[model samples]
Target chain A: MDIATQTETAPPPPPPATTEQQRASRGATRPGDRIFLGLSRGSGIVLLVIMAAIAAFLTYRAALALSDNTGNFLTTFEWDANAIPPKFGIAVLAFGTVVSSIIALVIAVPVAVGIALFISHYAPRKLAVPIAYVIDLLAAVPSIVYGLWGALVVAPNLTGFYSWLDTVLGWTGIFEYQGGAPRSLMTVGILLAIMILPIITNVSREVFLQAPKMHEEAALALGATRWEVIRMSVLPFGRSGIISASMLGLGRALGETIAVATVLSPTFLISASLLDPGGGTFAQNIASKFNEASEYGRDALIASGLVLFLITLLVNGAARMIIARRKEYSGANA
Target chain B: MSTTAPTAQAVTPDTLHAARLPRWTSPLVAIGSAAAAVGIGLAAGLHSRVQWGLIAAVLFVIASYVLATAVEGRRQAKDRFATSMIWVTFLLAVIPLASLIWETVERGSKVFSPYFLSHSMGVVADQDPGGGINHAIIGTLQQVALASLIAVPIGLLTAIYLVEYGRGKLAKAVTFFVDVMTGIPSIVAGLFVLSFWILILGFDFSGWAGAMALSILMMPVVVRSTEEMLKLVPNELREASLALGVPKWRTILKVVLPTAIGGITTGVMLAVARIAGETAPVLLLVWVNPFINTNPFDGAQGSLPLYIYQQYAAGSEASYDRAWAAALALIGFIMILNLVARGIARWKAPKTGR
Candidate 1:
């Protein structure tokens, strides 16, 4: 009884028409606000639903290929998808994708970083904008154009380089040439590198440009040369961004189709030598076989595509995580 | 900010002091001038031999400018060197674009007559490959339009959701997945559609399937571009609309969208241009029909990209010419769309006081 009386006495000090209560009462009937919130929430839900649907559809179809008896899908190399028992696997495709993309990264990253650094630090203001524009134009060039150019111009020119590599570095398995004209993994890698170079360069240039001017000046003031200043100030600040850019380029290279198909003449075998003119990527296999594929053959190709899709997804996801963590490095904020 | 000035000042002093020393400055300039003169004389002699005087002169000028920069201090020589480089970069970009355009126009001029537009490729045979791209043009329009219809709304809505309401786990997952989708190869997308719709579901090669494949490529681009444009929309507009008791979707459609319409159109046009040139995916999913098919769900249909691919694959000189013509036509269409997008952006951009 005493507690109840004390509580009542204390609460009675504030009127029934308190400010908070009045505000809450007034907010309850705001149908317009509720409607807006509902719409926004509904749109988000719809996006989630669509993503779920895509996953469901892909998994449902992928199941057909996965259910078949094969000695695990990743180990076997023969893509005799038309066999009555259908013995097939993705080892060649996986090897091809990883090898080509790795080569592309190896070739593209250094040049891309150099060009980015040149543009951001060395080039004068008048030259910088135009160079940047050129890079943008390069990025906008269609993949088919690049493929056509690669097939006609680059492939023919690579024959000389391939022979040179064979003559010089033949002891290393990777550079050993089996005397193919020009259709080889090395040529494909070069084409992939050219295709992805613009993207990596553009992203890295933006990141490098965003490096703190004061930090650079500080390094310079300590008697560091221009290159040393860049090394001390820009490289550390933009390292994660450069990684993200390379990952994005790698993702694109891994999944590129027409260019790989046009440039590579695969013989359905894997070799350590990039000059062997063998091994097929998932995208290249799908493109080459889709025109005349039988039913089971199509399913097998789709299964390979599923693997490619998952790999690209993993790569892009990692890129996004890196980019997200290093958002401050991006020039957009500046 | 205040601290930055001292370091900048300190760095500038040593470089400035070194620059002021004028060590071997006049001799360096004289030697550079002499080298330039010799180079010009040699180039002129070669030009006389080759009958290319203009090329020689331009090369001489470039060589002189580079030499001047090396001999002179950067402050005196940087401008000319930088200007020359800018021009070189511009030329590098313009040359291919111009060559591509010129080659296409030269080849396509043979078939740019009115009848070429009216007649279908059905009449043309391998023996005499000179009918028209009428069927291909129609098929391309229909398929790309259908792809846009499928991709645009979904992509735009997803972008809207991502930009406006997305916050936690689902949004991050969707963003990550969309990035993955963006990197997917066009041929693989075709394979996915072909296996699912044709092989498993027992459907035939139709324009609908081709559109589906294109949508797979187009969707992520549209979503990414639209999301970027939407993000550029100011947050104050949303708050203002919300304060005025407007529904969120309505505000997005009316206020946010109108504000970003210019960028959105550009993004959409770019996406269309991107998918329109896809050959591998359409080749895999849709059969090449000689005649036009209006119904996307019906029989096979021809598209510009596939037409070009087929003609080039024929490995004949005449067919290669036709391929170049088709390439021209595709480039023309994309350029027109780009021009229109630019025009729209210019028209819609907010006016500012002069």
Candidate 2:
């Protein structure tokens, strides 16, 4: 009786002891554990530091360039950064980037989705496997190679098609072609469309393949044709997936550098017609001018790159947000 | 309201008949569309074969739908339309990409010789015919090696931390930033290194500067892929090791890591392939060299992609051929990497339930 009373009166044995024991059991007391943890955690911290450094340094250079700016940074159309006063702006860059990427997304997304569905659902197993493999291989083809091909082979071949577009869609101001080299924003858009196709198709194919098989079977059992089944079951389930996939493609299209640089004959003016061989994307502008750019000129280019960086960040962040939000009701967790 | 016998008979008849089109219907429509398209092209004096193809595809789709509707009703027609559209789109996408590959091989083969492979652009002018990518190949190997050296260990460790020990806010923040980093433009990455390493630190153009930028782009891809690979390691293995009184670090290193090593290696190689093709960073930082310089730390380097870009910019028939040849080499290198990575993945896939 006395021992029991003494144990009961031991003042709960101190809560810190439990946590300390837990920590020790977690291997916190061992040097190997502590060192490994520290190393890995430090690596994570370093990665974060690098990301932070990218933004910070870009912004710093951008600030230096912006402070001496002799033009409205967002609205000025000219880009004579190497001049004594150094007047430069991202107006043409922003317009070109957004417009060309929009065109790419517009041209790529539907066809990509169709191709994805064809591979995932419509194609026979033998054909599907090889085509999917081909797409994957295509994805690995370097952008520089694509750019080279676009310049040499594709760009020359596009003239006939551009003329056709011009004749048919000439009433639309954007299709007016005062043709010279066929190196224009429209060409960039088409090439980007081709570039982003594999990525979008790959992602959407995976999503379409993951659509609940039972839901598809349920639709089929109700006498729905293949198209109706896809409409009622697969498309609904894969909607958010398609959106995120398209956004990923858009992000790539917006930031694609060498390809745009190779294919676009950039000028400062944003022509109403996409067929005009003018207007500069941020990445393309940086690449085309960096070789000749002075120190301040480099900073001005960095300023433009900073914009491209922020735009991609926003686009990618929004894509992640969409995926995250959809995960809640996507039945994926279940 | 109808009697059960009549309703059942009606359903049976409808199910039995269902108005199917013959298998040859599609081929017939295709041939018809092609002829019609050719006739239309001739009549309209259309110069572009692309226009001919487009007209044929449209005609095929429309004709198939109309025939299906006439024979098999609206629902089957809709299905036929969708099927034809998907097939057309697939063909549309595949044709241009195939042409790209075909053109690369065809043009590249004209100048791609052992002589081209063994020499460098030491004496050849842009318009001259005799030059090789030996220097470029060396530069690319060194820079990619440097980038992989920097990226792999850090990326692997970061992924290990996230998978094995990550808990609260720091882990969350790291994960988020890794995603953000993945989308950083290659050119932007170059700009960052330019601003920090070159502009502020007063560093000269070197392969080392380019490697730093390439590593920045490579690190995120490495981390993401390694994280995925690490996550694939079953929890049972880790738990079993811990239950044996092994320290958590040892368990992760000896048990979890070995089990996941194949996938991790594949991820690293794939990351290497990706960085190998990067041109913007090299363009910005490495500043091209025509002659072979083995020392990346001291001087400008010649890389395959940069070589291609420069050659293309030279705007000569000879340079264009050189560009195509270099592109072929780069593509072959990346394709080999991808194929090997995938081969490893298949060979070392986790033996679940075996």
lDDT of each: 0.73, 0.90
Writing each residue's lDDT as its tens digit, candidate 2 over B141-189 gives 9999999899989999999999988989999899888987888889999
Residues A1-334, candidate 2, lDDT per residue (tens digit)? 1222343445466876765554545465589988999999999999999988888999999999999999999999999899999998888899999999999999999999999999999999999988998877777888999999888888888877788789999889989987788999988999999989998999889889888899999999999999999999999989998999899899999999999999999988988999878898999999999999999999999999998999999988888778667767766624
What tens-digit string does per-residue lDDT give for candidate 1 at A100-119? 88998998887777777767
Candidate DockQ values, in order, are: 0.26, 0.73
Candidate 1 TM-score for chain A: 0.86
Q: Tens digit of lDDT per residue, candidate 1, span B156-219?
A: 8778768876778868777776776777767767766776688668898888999988987888
In model 1, pairs of residues that clash are A36-B248
- Whole-model lDDT, candidate 2? 0.90
**DockQ score for model 2, please?**
0.73
Highest TM-score scorer: 2
Task: Specify the CAPRI tier of model 2.
Answer: medium
Top lDDT: which candidate number? 2
